[model samples]
Target chain A: MAQEKTYIEDIERTLYDIKNVDKSKYKSQSGLTEDIIRDISARKNDPEWMLEFRLKSLEVYNQLSLPNWGPDLSELNMDEIVTYVQPDAKMTGSWDEVPEDIKDTFDRLGIPEAEQTSLAGVGAQYDSEVVYHSIQEDLVKQGVIYTDMETALHEHEEIVRDHFMKLVPPKDHKFAALHGAVWSGGSFVYVPEGVHVEIPLQSYFRLNAAGAGQFEHTLIIVEKNASLHFIEGCSAPKYNVTNLHAGCVELFVNDGARLRYSTIENWSRNMMNLNTKRAVVGKDGVIEWVSGSFGSHVSMLYPCSVLKGENAKCEFTGVTFASKGQNLDTGASVIHCAPHTSANISTRTISKAGGKATYRSAVKVTKNAPYAKCSVNCESLMLDDISRSDTLPTMDIEGDEADIGHEATIGRISDEAIFYLMSRGISEDEARSMIVRGFVEPIAKELPLEYAVEMNNLVNIELEGTMG
Target chain B: MNKEIFSEIPMRTWNWLGVNEATVDKDLLVESQKLDIDIEADHHEKMVVEYRKESYGIVNISIGENASLKLTQLQLMPEERNHANEVNIVLEKKARLQLVAVETGAKSFASKVNIILKGDKSQADVSVLYFGDGDRSLDMNYVLDFQGRKTVGNLEVYGGLMGESQKIFRGTLDFKQGSKQAKGYEKENVVVLSKGVRNRSVPIMLSGEDDVVGNHAVSSGKINEDKLHYLMSRGLSPAEARKLVLEAAFNPVLELIEDEVLRQEIDSYIKERLENE
Candidate 1:
């Protein structure tokens, strides 16, 4: 039996969809090797220690093995993945100075308009290289340091050297080791004490090179009593071949500081977005993460926070929508390593059209972390019998003095609710979409305005033909 | 995925079987026509499953018209792992069944139940007990479905988890689209052992094309500290006074067990679990 399939015809932001092959273009050899590592070090004009670090990372990457849990990644062979694709242009401050083709691609995606309206600063990376970077002048005068990682190393060497790859070391995992070996062009932000950057600093990653992998590294350090909000967005044009995104982000929140990181990812269907993000918060610090996942054929992501200091806090709010042909396994992790630490996490997910969505969470309260208070709540909606949703939440409580609670629910819409809507003359499709939109209302309300609109639109687009 | 979301998962891989036409295997996608499943439970003097009142993510079990069942269980508390349990039952027109559960607790323990009824006529009653520390939890749920014009059913639970513990209860009554003119009822109660224990009770009802009636109630908490002080005023040691209260609270559930040998085994387990310093 042949049945018609439904897909989003135009994924809204497809302007960055151009593809080309330049054999003579600046590039490195295939696969991960010493030669490839040396080539990357040369391209970045690295110092002596960085070069040695790259080689050491390559050794670790070789010894480590790929993770077997979550989505099966056996079909994604490393040999077929291009580690780096150095764009033709160096890092520039203005969009006009960039090559016309790349500039036009972003221009059509409304990047320039968004930067001008509300963003305090912006950094744009295109396939292993940052093509455009800039920040507001007033903040720079106020001692806020925001610039490319490589440039930061050369200009503010002491600060960059102090925090680079510290929270998450190369030995953390296999992909991390690989990221250390061939990482390129990401942002470095340092917020001064007691200062609050009102407008969010934004970074956008656009993958244009075919069969190439994007391994950008982001490092953010918020000093004592400072506050900052950073926004990140990623997208790629659909391709027949798989493109890999294995970026890394590490945040350090000092005493009494607060940092909120939000992300809206709309990768193309061929993308394998397996990125790592972790934060270490000092005494009395707070870290909040708001995440939305809407694309990719398969994804395995669980952002974690290590509450290291007394009275430190963490909150994670996330939403994931897995449509047909997509298997998205995403959640959050928190570890209370110190006494009086607390963490709260709430996640919502939707599975439709035979797609699979799984929410996995881990909360660990060490023995020394007495009086720790934590709660984890997860909810999933299985649209139909054919669609599947699963929730797996694990709790490890070593201290008897703490209060830890875990709750989860998995169910479908009540037939009576649908029947009532149908009796009111609403079409089945409209009624169903309305219910789902409301189902995800709490999560969408937490997102930025434009992103919230786009999320609802994606929901409508995904529900097309799923109604009976 | 977020700008930061990747945990170090132990690298393991599996050979996935994809679903596609021509090569699609139907054997991998069939629900067994013969639906026969059995579950056996064992506890060191006690086993407990509790739910908070009006809580979500509840596991529900319902009995329909003319349905018959045979159940046997044992409960004991070995002073260490105490469970305070509570459960609710509902019946309607000719829904006939029998359920037996065993319970034991160490310190704090409490139980409560609420039952409702519907259909032409029906009946049900359940019993359970607790022996533990300052442990309290609720086991509350209800099955309220109408029997086809004239049917009946019964439900009973006995068990407890205690030791500064908490329990919950859920009672549900569901009347499907059909089954006009039916009625039934059910009820449950529990005893508390120790302090610092908590329990919640929940009652549920669902009606479609219905002409039925049902009702239930649940209550749980710890032994009043003032009451313990009163026991001290009576010249009994704190441990002996605590044991007296536990024995009185568990008598209802203990009296219902038909086998004396089984009742003695549960009594010994309760004595062991409730042995506090």
Candidate 2:
């Protein structure tokens, strides 16, 4: 079964994996404790309740059991996991103030340049701190609150306290408890009632520290009749030692509001990224999720939605890339709690190498939701025979009037299409890449131009690995 | 070899497949008998499933002198499935058997399914729907043999899988030789509402004899994004819209189950599950 190895699997990208986990100042001691939570809180200058909340969450984190199904998390030892790592820098709204090393990292990622022209706002988090954040002054003057989560917690304490971790609380799952206990830098945005943000606001997270975890928290609230589009980007320099990203993103779309949240995570393979995100849509409100999971050794991310009011709806568009050494179990969940509520989830996955990409999804129509309807269509692309893709979907229809349809197909790029292209003189690799880009292009096309370009570039990079 | 040397084998021999002895449960098998479409004494030249009308004891075997039997109901069933009170019959030429099946259930237990189309020129039109909280595996396999020309068979199954129970559905339309001018169609749809549940749909088609037509198709997933976006953009959250689409998705399968009493029973079971879920 042995053949030639791929380029990305070789040592070419070792620079990204190079790591030095300091044993001194920032290393977390063994096990989770109130003192550890307190020390981290003191370091971050958390208010009284945030500190108390972290300790309360630590209590819950220690008590809850690991998930019974999905990919195994037995390898993730809390004692071995350093939940927090403060990069060597302070928060800076200006690019000049960010430490040279951190700035160079983001520069290589091209975040500052992407923010300069395309995005309306951008927040950059390095390791456990949001080292840089900025937004259009027009947006600032318009009362659209977009800032680093830490500053938001202190300046707009009311908003932070009211909606923090509400959609997915500490007890929702084991990692969520861990996130609530020791969460750090992320983004916070509030789109006011009847307002519309013309451009997408984006946040990029970089896990620059080795043997440490990045626990950022993102909180977004779109008030009644408001509309907003937010994008989140996550990537990390590679580290031989395993790092962890247990970030949490909670969104609340109030009555008549519209919110679309998009995220692209390109972490390194030595990372166990167990992120949790969820949203709640109010009466006549809507929420959309566009997710891309390209890297991470093992990732369990399923963004959920709850239609809590009559006529509420949700749409989840996601694409996952499980290349070598990645077990990405990603999908979505929805609960129709009110009559006539509805949801639709369309997802695509690409599995290469020996990676495993499982589309695990569920939609439940409560008996009280008399007229609920849901339709799911997911497709998977297995680049090679060794890679695996499994589609496990479930629907609980308590309402006779409900409609549910699910269809998924798993195959490689059609040989016919590839041959047809190659016959015209296009190289096989480029032809395959073109087909794959097309396969994932639908989800990419929905993102802002810069993000779409980034997604295509990532897909191209993965395609290069396929050939090498 | 196209030889018919094995007709003497006891009907009981088929039971050797189970862990239990072939004859230990003898009550379900009545007096050994022979049935024939072309007079068993003459048709016995080929490996045959012989039957006698009087063999069912005083059970009264009047399938109507005019009753016509369909021939597609004599094939193999997959392994490891649930069943209760099933009957097998080798039909005489031109006997009829009307078919109706309804599936419904409570938490963890899915609705029961029934299949009975074991005759020549007999039509088995069935519609089954399952709505419940728990996992119920449905493995329904049936075949019909055609002794006369222009025999037809049809089967439709619709069900919902909730909670953690896994559902694997297998439906096949097999057409045999000399059953020329015979045709069959089968379709199965399953809804998986929870990550804990498992759903598998295998729609199979095999034609051993020519001059017969058969086809099968399956569609499974969650909801559609266009539908979700349309609803969400209209001020409805994605979850509410999903419920709407799910109801619309399974409506066709539910509408085919006739029998108001049985339909309502299945409908209520489905509704009850939704409420509890």
Candidate 3:
């Protein structure tokens, strides 16, 4: 008898592929220009300083050149992409007040359900504006602030002006400069000093306009000795034309504070997900990152942590599954600037059906970082001969007291492991799925229960096939 | 004098990190010699070549079916100067090549080795030992490209950096498509003995065949305190114990030197550098 070859299908994106009518109240013209930036600023009632910042960022964006490395981006045409789209709705504190079509989109994504049971506060952004945002009154009374970025800029101008874009400057990269120039809606979170938020706050971004861009700026500051967990989720409906997501996330963990940031990115195949995220940890502070990348035509994201204070620490756990036309380049970066700082990064990537996955990272220990330690481990699983996986990591140490170690392995599932499982009555396909699940188990367990289930479903190993 | 890119990584990453490639100002056009060696079928051969007198050179070696070759190259410049060298090798079916490279001399040295397993069942094992002291700078790139089924490749690098020295090492294991059942491993260890030294490393593994196995590891740090204390407890001074620890790290590669005379010369050179600390 001839053995049958097992094949795993690509992520089932049916639920997220639900398209909405183009009911946007306003949409920027295709192509970037000074006039467009000025119009956006005027329409948003921009503060004088914000307008100056936007103009300066636009200048920087023009001066910068495209990255000469990583996944190909020649297909991303700024000349044809609409920089912003305002959904036909106003910001509301209640989901019932949101427009029916927009609410339906988030409702299908289970945002409402996740908000009720799993999240303490929830903010949902549709296109270029936050449509719904709400936080529990009890938490608000505890001096915790969770609201849209625009609201924070207006209500807490001093704090927002101080921390916004400080961690991820516009000159960090070309896309970052573009984001700074035309960014729209995201979340702002602040936990009071020494206060620990018991539950996680979440922000969901849905890009509904075709050939458009979503540039959100999320700023979070956990004050001294305070702790918080924040989750972000993003997705888009598949369109024939390309879409862009150049969102930026900046986090500040103050002295003795701790912050955990988690994200699940499931963009459509025609989307270019070029996102930037970073955190600055203070003395005795800790930062943890949990990430899942399941969809995107091309993605280049590396969340970074700057250990600026002595004894600061960071932990990163992430997984990327690339199938068919996907190329997901993701990893973590750490910079140790103070004595006794440490960081550990672990990631797993799976490639199938002509997909490609690359893990690229950098670890730098400055001369002042005596006794700093960093360890990086990455594993890649290729599902077939047509796929590709690569690991590229760099370590730059300026002092002998710093210790850095990196290990990477690339291979496929062992036939013996599959055979052993089959001998125990499991089917071949089931056995393979089981093995892949076990490979990503470490990263999955780091996520919230619902997000983990979502990730497993995206990976096509959930056994139930419920989320699609 | 001119500056050129050397020791480029297989797949370029973020250029801002400056590890994608190395640029050095040197006279690569210095009078260099070309040496070629060929081993016939079923034959075993061993040879030692030194670049101290030659200064700059290129070496190419090819092994026929079922042949085995053990080759050692030494780069111990007699005076302070700059040079760039290249080595290319190809192996046939069932052929094997063991290459040991010891580099310890030169004001600035750049070296690249490219090995391709072109036939089934071929294997390549490469060992590199380098020492960077004084104001010397070293840039090295080693790549093992697997093109044949069932091929095996292993790479190991050991080095120490002191003084104001700087070093960058890029090692890659590439498994091309149709190279089924190929296995490759690369390991690099750098011991920094002083505070002013700078060390950078990029260990990359690229795979296009699912059935192939690829692994790479890199580590950089100061001398092991426990081992140093143990040696000091055994009737050695602090400096002596430090030297011993570094010598132990380079011993495995040094022992691979087939020529006794050449091996001792390289060993003594390493000792002289360590003693200056």
Quick one: best lDDT, which candidate? 3
TM-score (all chains, Cα) for each model: 0.70, 0.67, 0.97
lDDT of 1 by residue, B1-277 (tens): 1121111111111112100001112231132112122122211111233222211111123334434333333434333332333233344344443445554432222222333344345444445443334433323233444435543333333333355554433333444434443333334343444324432222232333223333332322234456678898999888777666666566666766667887777776567656742
Candidate 3 lDDT over A182-272, as tens digits, reads 9999999999999999899999999999999999999999999999999999999999999999999999999999999999999999999
Name the 10 consecutive residues with the lowest summed lDDT in model 3 chain A. Answer: A459-468
Label model 3 with its docking quality class.
high
lDDT of 2 by residue, A1-468 (tens): 332222222113443443334322365664677888989999889999999899989889889888756777777777777777777677888999987767777787778888877789889988788889889999888899998999999999988998898778898888899999999999999988899998889898888666778899999999999999998988776767778889999999999999999887777888898998888999999998988888789998889899988889999999987777888888988888888888989889877667788777767666667667777777776655466665555454553446656555554556678779989999867787788778888899877776686676655533343232
lDDT (10s digit) by residue, model 1, range A1-468 = 332222322235444455534332476666788998898889788888788988999999999877646677876777777888878877899988988777776777667888899789989887888889989998998788888888987888788777877877888878889888888888999999988888889888888777778888888999998999998888888788888888899999988999998988888878888888899998999999989887887887788899998899998989888777778888888888888889989888877666777776767666666667787777676554355565545444443455665555444554566678989998766676667777778788888776787777766634344323
Please give the TM-score of chain B in predicted model 1: 0.52
Model 3 ranges with Cα > 4 A deviation: A1-5, A422-429, A459-468
Ranking by DockQ: 3, 1, 2
TM-score top scorer: 3
True contacts kept of each: 0.03, 0.02, 0.92
Of all native A–B interface contacts, model 1 reproduces a fraction of 0.03
Cα TM-score of candidate 1 = 0.70
Give RMSD to native, each candidate. Answer: 11.7, 13.7, 2.6
Docking band of candidate 2: incorrect
